[model samples]
Target: MITNMRKPTFIVKQSLKIFCLLTGFAVMTWSFSFTKYIRGQFVNLNVLPERLKEYMYFMGRRLNGAYLSSLNKADNHDIPIIFIITPTYYRLVQKAELTRMANTLRLVKQLHWIIVEDFEVINLKTQEFFQSTGVSFTYFAQSKRSETNNHHRGADQRNAALDWIMVNHNPSMPAVIYFADDDNAYSLEIFQQMRYTKKLSMWPVGLSGGRTYETPILKDGKVIKFLAWKAEKRKFPIDMAGFALNANVLWTYKPMRFSTDADPGMLETKLLERCCTWAEIEPLADNCTKILVWHTRTEKPKVRMFDNVLEV
Candidate 1:
């Protein structure tokens, strides 16, 4: 009697185990089918959020337009239009410097000179120099000085020139814009090599005190980093005179003038932060291989005046 009962119990336990396994398999199949069905419905209905669709559409259109425009412009017509901005104050030493720069630019025809003076009126000598050059030039002077700073009103002076460019010329027309100091020496070859600039072109500058050279970090014919004491930590670090920018970039960023409030060594950082990125920077002058410009400063000459005699 006990043996017969044990066999029935064993049969019942085995049947229960089989039922649970079958039920689990059926549940898993149903879950999988439901998931597939939902995915299929989403795909067929194209049920993406409206905002996402709009964003993607806008991006696609913008990219297409940029691509077509770039393709049209890339005809190997390396005729780069260069605009030079020079901020001048108390033009005694700058006369020779300006002459040197003007002479160098004679070889480069597509050049526009924008000279900003830190005064309400342009000096007679500066006026005469520009008149003699017969080059395309514009002169601007700041009306007043509100701050007592070494780089007093420098930001305002630069902004005045930039504003003039935007108003007078097509913002996207020029190929390169350079911020040059009145005292620095520029090489003619610098202008020639800058024609290859897609965005920004940089090279080594010869500074004072036998410091030898200054330039950006190059890796595989590209600037991966900036090798300057001023810009080691910043995304890119080079002197204001070390690089040339595309006019389109200037229009795009539209920096709000240079600031005296900024800490020392912050001018480049602030200006660059607004307009440039590391990838856009192309380093030339590799180990002074293509050094065309030198960071030269003019020394102020002394003049003695005799009584009852006027010095011109």
Candidate 2:
């Protein structure tokens, strides 16, 4: 009886020892792999105090903006830069939305992101987030003013971005400008199609206008008419996600802007009228048959209880 009891106890002890050893090995392996990742992020760091550098690196472990910095430094004069203008407002999902957009934009080369906030003053938290995104970006806030009932939402913010381009952008530099909404889904292929837009380029937008998609009907590689809900009513009936404009167009037509007083759904037409006509519109993405962009809107989060607890 005593021998039998001892044998069972010894087996239990051996099993426990094996389990602990396996657990410890896993933890050590994970630690080493994580350390390598952190060290890799700081490989290109050249000039900063050790303390500050450490703080910055640890604060944003995903420092992958090296590609944009290098591209900006390169003397590639022929590569047209795609300037993406995003007008954003404060909301529970704002950070999450921008983070998603940044991840996509980071993969794109020669892209400059211009984000305009609909706030009276610049938000520091947002600035830090943008810096960590690893994409070339310009950040600013919209001017404060009372809005009339007829003024379309986000018109001021979009106009502010265009204003920045007018004052700051070099017209001689080959570039294309796109009005990218924060909540939309964009494919890198769309960026490629619009990169060398001579005047104005357009493609199909998925899930827009309460339909599957909206696009400009093309005939012989030219935009003949829009295949949208109110195509016959407006000059440019497609959603904002469907088009890209040449940066030179904005510079050439200095006063062009989205009309604040334009009725709902008329903003696109107001701006496009100043830029190009139907005959001048260029079709892209296999002559407008491809759905490269989506007008996706995030469902509002129920954060009443969580709002005061922490930032979402």
Candidate 3:
């Protein structure tokens, strides 16, 4: 009887030891995963204080003149410089849209407009437009072909601007980049919102994504979901006009490119998915309350050719 009691007691003690060991192992595994996730985010460029500080210095500068000052700030430079990448193809409407966009952009201070053309040389109108308008701009011509079909557009023109930025800029340059289609309509207030982006920020875009508006659903200052019901089946289902990534993210993730392998309308999604996820995205434009941009495409201008010559 004494031996039997001792055996059962020993067995119970061994089982308890095994359970404690397994529990400790599970806890360690969970802790390691959690630490890795937090470390991954903190390690990214946007989280580094030095990078944001470098760019913030420019926006915090004050200047005289009603046009120079942001409505909210006495100092016009107290915002991130908006680096506008416009990929334009020659068209009669191109001049009109460029002029309109320039007019709107001039109202915003600390902005750089980079216009890249699809052809091997800059368009004459593009050169003339910036000169007369007095907008801060850099003009470049893409060395490769642009769109060969309707399915392919803005890839080459956009890449040229990205390449320029990568070569000329370092990770510390303080700026927010936006791909502004020539036809879009934007509010000056939008630049201010984009300037403060910590990582990647998204807002509502009008007349895009086969819907009236495609926007993020914000919950307690974070993006919980996107509102474009039509794009529910797609990954990162948002319009190109819907989001802007911090230039720091670009400098850090220098390999980002628009690829032919990407499915139609996912150019923005694929490019961004690798950089940040929906949870990392910060929703803007009044916490998803306002529409600061519109995809306002102008009617294609009518052109005529007579006697085997093109007519404008």
In model 2, the Cα lDDT at residue 247 comes to 89
Residue range 8-114, candidate 2, lDDT tens digits: 99999999999999999999987876554345442334434555444434333222222111224133456998888898876667889999999999888888888
Order the candidates by TM-score, highest first: 2, 3, 1
Q: In model 3, what lDDT does residue 312 have?
A: 22
Total clashes, candidate 1? 0
Q: TM-score per candidate, in order?
A: 0.67, 0.74, 0.69
Per-model lDDT? 0.64, 0.77, 0.70
* Per-residue lDDT of model 1, residues 128-185, tens digit only: 6676876667765664456635453466777777777677666645567788877887
Question: Which ranges in model 1 have alpha carbons more than 4 Å from their true place?
Answer: 1-78, 143-153, 208-210, 286-288, 306-312
Instruction: Provide the global lDDT of candidate 1 against the true structure.
Output: 0.64
Write the residue-wise lDDT of candidate 3 on 146-201 in tens digits.
44333547777787788877876555657788888889989877787888788888
Best by lDDT: 2
Worst 10 residues of 1 by lDDT: 62-71
On the 0 to 100 scale, the lDDT of residue 119 in model 1 is 63
Better of 1 and 2 by lDDT: 2
TM-score of 2: 0.74
- Which RMSD values do the candidates have, in order? 26.3, 16.4, 24.4
For model 3, give the RMSD to the true fold.
24.4
